[model samples]
Target chain A: EPEVTQTPSHQVTQMGQEVILRCVPISNHLYFYWYRQILGQKVEFLVSFYNNEISEKSEIFDDQFSVERPDGSNFTLKIRSTKLEDSAMYFCASSEQTDTQYFGPGTRLTVL
Target chain B: AQSVAQPEDQVNVAEGNPLTVKCTYSVSGNPYLFWYVQYPNRGLQFLLKYITGDNLVKGSYGFEAEFNKSQTSFHLKKPSALVSDSALYFCAVSTHASGGSYIPTFGRGTSLIVHP
Candidate 1:
């Protein structure tokens, strides 16, 4: 089965540096999403992308966060200025036409 | 806003025994419920979902979930527990009210431990 793939399984960056998490969703999937889970916390939605634009975003997806589909298969989430609280496991997910989403292994972001 | 509730923080079961992970949901319109499992250091794996038809939905790794609209529940079940099944489980719900969006509102995960 085809699965969503993410690069840089683990990312470590300085507190004030910029970080970009990359994901390659399923080739045929139309809807892509970003979610994060703080250690020992529930997974929280960050943003959803479709048709090369953001469909919806949560409060956590503030000014520092931006998502771009730079290519057909690559979906990138960029954080302008990383904060300590931004350290979490970021996940990328995609779906064909249903609510059933397939998630990537996730990228663990650690801010120093 | 649609929401999901996983009442239990943890559930312990013995190997070879049946196990259940309960999930309840609140949605304004038709509910699209799902169950996902996560192993340590990994992402959430899709377990199963309930869209519109039958209430019982079977998914990967011998997992199944039953959707009860009257009670607003979508509980996941496995007939037999395995040590490999020990992991964190999450329940999620989406509604048509959100423009058929696939974004799911997830509940706090429940950790399941199967003791041998």
Candidate 2:
């Protein structure tokens, strides 16, 4: 079965540096989402995208975070001025409709 | 806001025995319940979903779940446990927010360990 794919399975960056996590959602998916899980914590929603615009975002998705469909298949999450608390496993998910979402393996971001 | 609660932090079962991972949900409207599994170093995989069904939903890897609306719970079950089934399990509920947007609220996750 087709699945969501993410690049740079692990990312390490210095504090205050900019980082971009990339994802390629399933080809035919209509809704895309970004979520993060701190070690030993529940997965938290970051943002959702549809029709090339943000549908909703959580309070954690503050001014530093931005998402864009840079291309037909590429979904990117950019964090400006990363903080230590930003270190977590970031997941990308997509759905054919808006009901069942398939998640990617996730990118582990380590900010120091 | 929609929310999912996995009451147990961990469940231990012996191999060849039955296993159950509990989940409960709170939603404003009808619930779309789902179970996902995560192996170490791997992404979360869809196990099954309960969406306006007959209350019993079977999914991959011989796993199944029952949806109870009255109790507001959807718990995952496996008739026989395998060591390979040991992993982190998460329950989620789908709901619509303003502007007709659908979002999933995930539980904190429960770790299942099957020992031989």
Candidate 3:
């Protein structure tokens, strides 16, 4: 079975520094999404991307966060300036026709 | 708005016993419910989903869920539990919006522990 793949399984960055998390969704998937799970917290939706534009975003996805499908295969989430609270396990998911989403192993971001 | 609730924070069961992780959801329209499992340091793995089908939906790893429309619940169940099944389980719900499918809302995960 094809699975979503993410690069840099663990990321450590200083506060106020920019960080980009990369993911390669399933080959034929259309819709992509980003979610974050804080330690001991529920998974929170960050943003959804379709057709190279943001389809939906949560209040937690503020001005500092941006997503890009720079290429046919790569989807990236860029945080302009990281905060300590931003440290979490970031997951990338993709689906065909918005039915069932397949998730990647996730990138653990540690902001210090 | 769509929301999912996993009432229990943790459920402990002995190996070879049946186990259940309860989940309830609220949605405006028809619901698309799903169950996912997460191992330590791993991503969410698709367990099963209920989308306008028979109430009982079978999924991967000998697991199944029964969707109760009247009760608005989709609870994950496994007949015989294994130690490998110990993981964090999450329930999610989504519904159709104006244009297309709505973003899924996940419940706070329930940790399942199977003691040998």
Candidate 4:
């Protein structure tokens, strides 16, 4: 089965530095999403993208976060300035229609 | 807002015994419920979902979920337990939100440990 794929399984960056997490969602899926889980916490939604625009975002997705489908397959989440609290496992997910979503292995971001 | 509740922090079961991971949800409209399992160092894998179904939904790895609208719950069950099934399980509820999308809210995960 085809699955979502993410790059840089682990990322370590200095505080206040810019970082981008990349994901290649299932090729045929039309909707994409970003979520994060701080260690020992529930997975939180960050943002969703469809039709080349943001569909919705959570309060946690503040001024610092931005997502873009730079290419047909690549969906990228960029954090303008990282904070310690931003350290978490970031996951990318996609769905063929709107019901079931397939997730990627996730990228563990550690902001020092 | 749609929300999911996984009351138990962890569940322990013996090998060959049946296992159940509980999940409850709150949603304004009809809910789209899902269960996902995460093995250590891996991503969340879709176990099953409850859309407009016959209440009993079967999924991958011999797993199944029963959606109870009256109780507003969707719980995952398996007839037999395996050590390999030990992992972090999450329950989520999705509802229509702004931007013409259905956003999911996840509950704090429940850890399942199967003892041999």
Greater-TM-score candidate between 3 and 4: 4
The 0-to-1 C-alpha lDDT of every candidate, in the order given, reads: 0.91, 0.93, 0.93, 0.94
Instruction: TM-score each candidate.
Output: 0.96, 0.97, 0.97, 0.98
Residue pairs with backbone overlap in model 1 = none
For residue B20, what is the lDDT in candidate 1? Answer: 96
Candidate fnat values, all: 0.67, 0.60, 0.54, 0.79
lDDT of 4 by residue, A1-112 (tens): 8989998899999999999999999999999999999999999999999999999999999999999999898999999999999999999999888778889999999999
- Which digits, one per residue and each the tens of the lDDT, describe model 4 over residues B1-116? 77899999999999999999999999998899999999998999999988795999999999999999889989999999999999999999998777877788999999999999
Return the TM-score for chain B, candidate 4: 0.97
Model 3 stretches astray by more than 4 angstroms: none
The C-alpha stretches of model 4 lying farther than 4 A from their native spots are none
**DockQ for model 4?**
0.83
Clash list (residue pairs), candidate 3: none
Q: What's the true lDDT of residue B104 in model 1?
A: 87
Sort candidate 3 into its docking category: medium
Question: Each model's DockQ?
Answer: 0.68, 0.72, 0.66, 0.83
* Worst-scoring 10-residue span by lDDT in model 2 chain A: A93-102
lDDT of 2 by residue, A29-69 (tens): 98999999999999998999999999989999999999999
User: In every candidate, how many clashes are there?
Assistant: 0, 0, 0, 0
Model 1 C-alpha lDDT per residue in residues A24-70, reported as the tens digit of each score: 99999998999999988889989888788887788899999999999
